[model samples]
Target: MELKKKPTKKDNFVFLFKGSPLNDFLYPFKKAANQWVARYIIVTFAIIIRCAVGLGSYSGENQPPNFGDFEYNRHYMEIVTSLPLYQWYLQDLGNSNFMLKFPPLYAYHSFIWGIIGKLINKSWFELNNSIGCQDIDLKSFMRITVLFSELIAYIPSVIIYTRWMGRHYNKAPSIDQTIIAATILFLPDLAIIDHGHFQYNSFLLGIALIALNNLLYDNLALASIFFTLSICFNPMILYYSPIFFFYLLSLCFVPKFNLIRLIYIGVSVLLTFIVIFLPFIYSGGIQLLSHILYTTFPLNFNILHQSYPNFWSMTNHLLNNNIDLSNLKNLSIILTILAISPSCYAIFTNTSKRLLPWCLASCSLSFFLFSFLIDETSVLLPWMPVTLLLNEVDADVISMICWFFNTCLFSLMPLLKKDGLLLQYFVLGVLSNWLMGNLSWVRKFVNIIIPFISQRPNATPVLPHSYSWTATIISFYVTATIILSCDLLQIQPLVEIENFWEISNTFLSTISFGIFYVWLNFKIYTIHSLKAKSD
Candidate 1:
């Protein structure tokens, strides 16, 4: 027999026996702390760039220099210990104005942030809502608050990402995972909330991803709570119930299981369903989930109508009267059909190891297909990229596409916008927002808030001084370089990138990234296959 290499210190980890109770308890915490310390750069970068995108760029008020957090922040105050949750939730004013009230999950999240924000400024509410730059510049407070809150938000997700990385077969630690975690954890759309119109998705999205992971691992109770919480925030997750249900079916019927596994699966499903349905059930005391929640599937916000309150509406409104909802329905079906091609194959043929990736890919395709022909609901498209990133799997072309798009965004946005192409930016935002703002109600508020806040903040007038074409050129090049470096990473695709030219540039980069990723995947697969045969 060929000599087996001795286990090295590099491969030794706290989680070599992580399944044990002592190890599980210690490792997840230790891994979390380590990842927290090690991932400082990625996390910091994720927070700061997103902050600049808000502070340096503009807030939803597009108030050139304004970055207000909420409309009635004064009433509820920022998340602080002084206020009671009941008081925060029971508030009457900020609800519909910002659409923060409807989604139960996000309202709760805002409760937490409001408490923290209140503690920070004591009158951050006044600073945010009232028309005056407080003891600090609107820009500085705007940037600092977003950066600080987001940093606070990351505490839980780093824990989750560390657990995920530690779960890999070799129990390896990856900087790649840290980087991807940072991207998901510091979603620019949510991070920009303080900079513009942020709601509760920032930290909660991580919880959603964790819930998804737990569901696949057959941890139903926690997953159900998370999924429910996620849905409470965005409500669009209710659409994903079909995915979850089908997954439950596969777990129950498709997989052959031992008695314990079967018991585990059964309890997981029952507990998850009960937990997810718990809130509505308590309200009605016997609310029919099939009628109240499931019936609202394929939610119709005039999705077929071009004027259908899409992400692109603020930038430019279009009237496409000829289409019907049936058309959107048909289109989503066709797109779903397209998505199933590779995804179904991967799921059925790939080994158990591929389940997470397959599920994510399928969900992403369903979302994408829905966006493509569903009139103007396309703003939800960027979520496809974000959701796919959580899968933590990539191929050559996909990686290249991600990188190329990122490069194109910074390099391309100003050039195209300067040339009278707000439409292109709208499409990008539509897709980005759609993907990132997977929660519909959250998306709706942002759709209104960003533009609503576009005017100058009356309190402190910072004139709208976008980079002059010259300044833009210099700044954009620097931005493009940083983006290019990440593109080289290609952990997530460039749907997050800004404009058409950027997308085109990203497409070009994808061509290169695809080649490299393919080679790498091939090398790994070949080695694995050989090793398997040898064994």
Candidate 2:
């Protein structure tokens, strides 16, 4: 018979996970408080962090000619709340210039929130007077909206999903589920973008999470409905639609395929679209709806979204900015389809719930990497699936995700800095790192100053001693340092160049994201091959 060694108190400190040392320092508190208390504590901490970040400047603090996304969102609310249903998307006044570019569901959501905003302060939605509004009460109201959305929708969705997955798979303990849920809620990019940068991303993401939760429960019809709702709220969620399409279609091929379920899902989706769009059709006819569709998926912009880190962005920069990919829109669409096809195929072939998140990440990342005219904020999309994998998975996977999280933050450095969010970035980054046990590596540097705190072995080493891995780690760190130095020192551009720091950051981010893209593709291919061999 095999003998098992007894777990020491130190091992008990890592009880949130079995035989894992991640966040060992937090174990004492976990032990002291019950699971519910610990979960609430983490949720409260996440909310507090968001509220703290809300104090920073928003997208366009005082800019006049045309403000940034903050002003655009305010305009959206004003139109949705004050304008007639048909006229909401067609508002062309100077102050109402942003108009309702999003789908009708999001417009209705904004309408409700705008009513609340009006209740708080009448001037907030007072048509032209609300233009470029930046009062403290307005800011507070906006922040509260995001927080409330997250609290009511996103946080609960993630927690329920994680707990459901844990129970279904029996993969890890309850504490691990709570930790994963909390960590997903505490992701810095989501908090920074939604709360600090000012948007309704968490709400959209929450709806998507609920869709995935329904999928986990094998409630395919509800999953389809929830996903339809998500896409209506933010059409960008369609980036993952291809994989979902194949996955759901594959389900129809399973044994004893239920025609009733299929019809139910189809009707649910059709009714949803009808309910949201029928009013618009009644008010303004198909032409107004066509115009709304045109604005939602605008194609006039150039390939790069102001040097966003993507394939076209880097390619254009490398070719001395002479290549006009705007002329190759058809080719761009073709390549994006090609890039995402493999992952969709994998998901279709696998059709396993365990592989869903990975396949989702793969497809969404392919879109982010190869699709035309993606923004930095869209990083949160791929991150949603990746973040869902932060349970007691492989340590290497966890470490890779940690690095990717940091890369996502670094990629948005220029945007974050422009919005005066540097402090939030630094503080939240450190806190998230500490929470994930990524800061254990800091003990090595800390031991150089204070020796006692460094004795515990790192649960996840920052870098392996292998040549390729070490080189990659060192190069990434060096690149990050250079980018930070360039930003902090306000490096002046050469005579021929403008915003050189931004350009460099964009280039580096593109390279890092490209590496990750390759890794994801490789993972998808490997999983498919292994499964094929097993079959």
Candidate 3:
């Protein structure tokens, strides 16, 4: 027999060299050029929306003051700017005694805006005192100020996140990647509008993301400093700091020397503490830290007067006239430690099977799980996993979970607060119980008979990665488009209980929750099945 057509030594060497992935450049890094364009479109739209709201009437000339009225925002802005530390750098807050009225950061920003208004017009006193008046002509500008600050701060986070995520895995983000990034940007429903027309969180959230990204990559000092700076803007972001500390502690046993990294971590913590405490060190720095930490972590339930009534807070309210937190300082610490311990242990042991995405996911989930059950906080939940969950290209599981959650959130847009009841609860009765709020017979009938024929009124997940018609036509995307269209067209909601989509909203929420449960369970089972097969 003739000799087999085997490769020569040179052929084998060239083939082996070419096959190595060591020198390959990550495509996502190159995709940065495209990322920038997409990023612009996303931010520009957000900015324009903010500008519109900023210009829109906060108080209805004819419509009565309701949940999201201009008065609510204006009053809050005034209160925020009145805080002692807010305008410490300026003399205006000093003269006006703004310290007693608002939080430090709130006053600080007001001073800056006041200065701008005065510069553009005639007098500082007139501008500052009458900032919201049409005569001052500053309300529109202030609105723009509040909105742009948030939008601008939030945009840069994607850059670092994209790079770190892309480099770790060395790939361009897929379509799912863009969706995930977009989701993170759009997660907080109220945050967007609140920051858009009346408030600010972009600065704090942006700083928090920077700190987290750095800490994840082992740049502890930079991370700590970034965190400290973020705290100065909004104190509510520190609930997840334990996760970072635990991350640092874990590096102590990296199986290889990382002494420089350890130094960086120590420096980071020290710098953060200094930044946070420098102003109040004389007043009582440690006390300030403890107080801020307690108040900031997950935020106090009552900060927003219309807080989502949770089991704890609602129960507390019933037992007393109000929810008493007189004994909560230590309780909160204990709760946080207990809640975050699993992640800490996993991080320290370097034994977490789900560190990267799970880190963000765990915190995001914890915020939702442990907070006072507000609808607004639900927005932040998806970003945790969506951005960091790029370990495998076929992330069908993650995508499905995100899709369901998006549905639940989108469905909730129409219902916020009305009278004594959260509007969504009533909607649940309608959609889940066929528009019946009280008739048990009808509810029972719907449950017993409808289940056999119709699909449950559930938050349905988008299909997995295949290019099926269903996958391409994301229901949440469709729903969102319709809702946006309705808002633009000033069309009333569909199938209203009173006159709009009533029970259907609640039905969609239930469906979303159901789909998320199923999709998560499926992922858990698939991973286990694969592991079992491999073993």
Candidate 4:
């Protein structure tokens, strides 16, 4: 007969450390009343990981000529806090470069942080003189902001969402929910890019997740409010706007179109925009708001940046074999819309909560793969949905998620290398695979191959892999590793092309991501098909 483990105070503490010495070190917690010891431990571990990554090089660490996003964020702090509200968007700070292009919600956040920064060290956010100022204290302050915001906003929202999902699934074990929360909390790409590479994507992503959570609770009013907040914080989340719109509209179709709920949701969204933008609008009127909007959405920028691994980038490579891309931006938009519509439609008609994440992933991945001017970091958008789906512990789903996660990491590898995060990437890569239980077969295979390659017996795997899942994963990862090694080693270029390796890296990653995107859509379709048949 199978045995069921009885719950005890020590149980939570033991689970917290998974039998690590730390459990004995904190034995007092075993007797404590809180049943959430394991969860708190996971949260603490996640924070420690973020802090460790924060110790590494950040985006635009020392580039004197034009520092990257790190400086851009601090610059925004100075512009918004130092300048008048009317001049926030219109300022020529940083010599018309790194202008305050973000929406007012982000501007307000900067302003709040800027005030704190000025108190800590006035020079940190001082006008042009502070440009490229990589002050240690200031850098620490910036990292802390990202870390704290993630802890308070993103991590908590994910935990809450997962717990709610657990409850919805008929009281699944809290330990399972905690594990899912930790996985999402410690998503390597999100931590490395936002905390290490320097961005506020977590803040925006957190708000969006809360919005989704509210929708799950049937709190349409709160969902609209938070969704508006997300868009205001970062307009890039508009890629998800379609999914939320369709799902919320679908609600109207059911239970006979409740006009009051519809009006409440609409007005809530409308008022959020009005309140957030009122200061900008009042200071400079409609033209000012329009200017800010234009700044936020610079459609005129190149349709395909060299760093992005999207369809246009691959196509541009095929056309010109060079980084300077030329594409019909209008066509890219049309294609993105067409690609996203089916997923949105599926969600609108079916409206399964389980399918919501899949739909959002499809929409965001579609935008990331096909849309114009996608940033390398935009992978985090789709990652939110993928990570949320980790509650599904099926082996196939886990393997697929891991593959996509690795692909996302690989697509951002060049940027991560630029940030000097090679060590952190390796550690997190191995650790993530280990946690996911994706290591065994690859380790055995490595043992089998070591005798032939190194004339050594009983060799251990340097890293774990989901290699047994598919030959395609093995090939893709092997090629990616070779490409990454070449880039890291700065291998000699072919006589014909100066950036042959770089182009090859982008081309390979783009193709791989494109294949992953198609696979994801197929998975979503398969789920829909199963749901249909079951119904």
Q: Which candidate is the best by TM-score?
A: 2
Against the true structure, candidate 3 reaches a TM-score of: 0.59
Model 3 root mean square deviation, Cα atoms: 12.0
Model 4 lDDT at residue 76:
92
Error of 3 at 129 (Å): 4.3
lDDT of candidate model 1 versus the reference: 0.42
lDDT of 2 by residue, 92-127 (tens): 575444666788888888888899888888898898
Q: What local lDDT score does residue 272 receive in model 3, on the 0 to 100 scale?
A: 62
What number of backbone clashes does candidate 4 have, counting pairs of residues 3 or more apart or in separate chains? 0
Q: Mind sharing the TM-score for model 2?
A: 0.92
The C-alpha TM-scores of every prediction are 0.52, 0.92, 0.59, 0.88
Per-residue lDDT tens digits for candidate 1, residues 407-526, read 323333433333333343444434432332222334335657675533321110011123342343334346555554554465345635544233444333333323323333343345
- Compared to the true structure, candidate 4 yields what TM-score? 0.88
Residue 331's lDDT in candidate 2: 74
Please list all clashing residue pairs in model 2, or write none if there are none: none
Comparing candidate 1 with candidate 2, which one achieves the higher lDDT?
A: 2
Task: For candidate 3, give the lDDT of residue 522.
Answer: 43
lDDT of each: 0.42, 0.77, 0.46, 0.77
Residue 120's lDDT within candidate 2 is 80
What does candidate 3's lDDT look like per residue over 33-75, in tens digits?
Answer: 4556555555665465445434443332223323333333343
**Candidate 1 or 4, higher TM-score?**
4
